[model samples]
Target: MDQISLALLSVFFLLVSIVWYSWIFKNWTKKLPPGPRGVPILGYLPFLSHNLHIQLTDLARKYGPIYKLWLGTKLCVVISSPSLIKEVVRDHDAVFANHDPTVAGLVATGGVDIVNSPYGPHWRNLRKVFVREMLSNKNLDDSGPLRRYEVRRAVRNLYGKIGTNVDVGELIFITEVNVVLCLIWGGALEGENRDKIGARFREKVAKFVELLGKPNLSDFFPILAKFDFQGIEKEMKGVLPSVDEILNSVISDRMKIMEDSGGEFSSANRRKDFVQILLDLMKQNDIVIGGTDTTATIVEWVMAELLQSPHAMQKAQQELTQVVGLNNIVEESHITKLHYLDAVIRETFRLHPPLPLLIPKMPSKSCTIGGYTVPEGSRVLLNVWTNYKDPQVWENPTEFKPERFLNDDDNGKWDYIGNNFHYLPFGSGRRVCPGIPLAERMVTYLVATLLHSFDWKVPEGVKLDMEEKFGIVMKKSTPLLAVPYQRLPSLDMYE
Candidate 1:
């Protein structure tokens, strides 16, 4: 055949194959949820917005509550309706319990930590250690003194900067990280070393979180993951060593102590801090990142909302004053009685959940949700932010109103347990955040201490910025800068 005839035949075969494949795909995915079309190969990746949560929500508005998108070669289904979310997280919890860890996540956690570990026996064991040993009621209760000490220390630090502008997020981040370290290994590191190590750990963790939030092409196209085109995974690996070094030192010291004590570390004689418990099972980086980052982010968001809404702040302060009194400092014991403060926290969570989309869940097997076929290994994102802001479910959903939670109309109506799908700030079902108990205690205690001790306002000529910077953990685009004035009757209380 002539060159032109050969070329024409090749083109004809290519067009024929494309038509055949398109037909097969249309028929195969007939039951799949509808979504926007995308260009070849790249799929909808090129069209994605930086704020994926809001973008997904906007897509939901167009394509209905449950919609699918092809991100490169990956199939992602975002479910925004409460009912559809329940179908995925509740009804088919087991099938969809596995996490689809990104390259950064895998590198940071080493694919063994509870957050990103595949749903299986190993994951179950890790979770058990986390829940029963680290975050059990007994453990948290035991760590109360440490938590209180850290919060008090933070308040004292703030006392020195009274009337000076402070980065609320940074302050809370430092305090929460310290609190978490103390809870994990209170007596292990002390004095200057503790501060130095804590600051370094925070620096590394900040990088880790930022990297985790960054868009990586490797995640969309697994075939390209080996190349590390964005270098996100490489950067994450670099950051992990510093974190691992600190953890290793702590672990080695603890091991030496165990050896010095002649196996008494295993006996009832040894203290049962989180580190002691984790040493029995495995070294965990997830708990450090997950516990500290999420708690601090929530505290920051709550504080930002409070500073912006003076009435809400005053109400929370009033509740704190009434519960703990002006003369005494806020304590964990006072957390339960501060119902209005609880409402404010709930409201804050409603408005700005730290993990807006929650951790991505991957199905271990093919499952059907909302009468649509969810192929095995497909990524499932429950749009908790959209659910929280849905006008159909909430009255004036955009308005920051804590009173909505204060009513006694229904017991346990709004909670983080993931029972109420519409209000799943901590997510739901079997893969629900295992850190709920500890997170609740940390956030409430931190907020109460800060508010009860001082009245905070945005610095002069500064407007409180509620704009969110979307990441693995959603945070304020601008760090909250506020000056705090002493609210307590006695300055001695701060000391």
Candidate 2:
């Protein structure tokens, strides 16, 4: 053969050999589990729907609750059945407690924040600091006056909107944000400070949610993970610095207050809000970025759901009236007495969990769940949304029925606290939401207070749409718009 021909042949053979080796190695790694077949390199990335959770849910209906899918260099096992979900999140929680170390999560969590930190000494120490400083019942009680004050303000603001149509979602967000911000800051904003603080918070939160929730094709296609395929990087880069500044400034301001007045009254007896406690812990190298973010989202979703379900709203109102009485305003202390209201909140959470799939839970060690071997370091999803809607455990799971939880015997003596895999709104095991007690009180208080304060109705000629779109939380498909009519001046609130 000619020299030129021999050279070309040598090059072609090398190329063929490389491709053959790559293909063989890919299949060798592909022996994990059953899932939709994918093209080389992409590995289900192309077939992935925009809303991955919904797509996974539909796939679960056909593939069974426990199935596998490949995301880039990672193998993910999704747990959709309550029984298996319970096994992973409750029975064997330690093995599945790590947070997936995606680029965005690392950037947001500061590599040490409690939410994304791996389950270890650092997480344990941070949890101790959190539980002692912020999550304690004393702290919750200390913050009660602030919460009640905000609730009163929110109730009054809603009352002012009587006879007029307003975006109830936005209004509720504003109210909830004020409550959280007040709990973070020393007190609620007033006049121009209110607008400024509210605007800054809204802007920061919107930017964060938008940047965090978008599809990171890179997450599934590791080769392209740096591509920031959806402009998430560009948006986050522009927004995060400003967000960090806002948070840091708040922290610094609180520290300055502590420095200026060296006394227990300033550091100890002073009103300790969530931010102040976090600030104190920041001195010990502990902090969290998504704390306020999740709180805001949960409150937003609860309102969105309640606004859409008027029957649920009416029932909650009836319960509030019975317990709180027609002449008295609902308070946080009244929540336990309002059993129906609590059930309604639980039902809402079931239908629309704040974190539908939950921040991905990673396994620290290899484990078998539902007959599928999940290798160590696999990204695991609890599939809270699917579990809550499972027909096997819940009768007519899709329907909104608060009564299902009204009594332990209603669903044959179902115990919600430890319902195995059937329901997990706040997750399970050691990782169950530390904020549940606070979140529950806040939700029940606002819900009961609103029901007692006004009569909300779908605006004339407008129907409530229950469609949902997921962000940080699953939000209503349409912004909930309601025309609340003023009722008789019966709910007597304190000054």
User: By summed lDDT, which 10 consecutive residues of candidate 1 come out lowest?
Assistant: 263-272
Residue-level lDDT tens digits of model 2 in 145-202 = 8888777877777666779987765665566667766777767245567646666766
lDDT of model 1 at residue 191? 67
**Model 2 regions lying over 4 Å from their true place:** 1-31, 226-229, 266-269, 283-311, 410-419, 490-495
lDDT of 2 at 483: 78
Q: What C-alpha lDDT do the candidate models reach, one value each?
A: 0.84, 0.69
Taking all chains together, each candidate's TM-score versus the true structure is 0.93, 0.87
Top candidate on lDDT is: 1
**Model 2 pairs whose backbones collide:** 72-220, 82-421
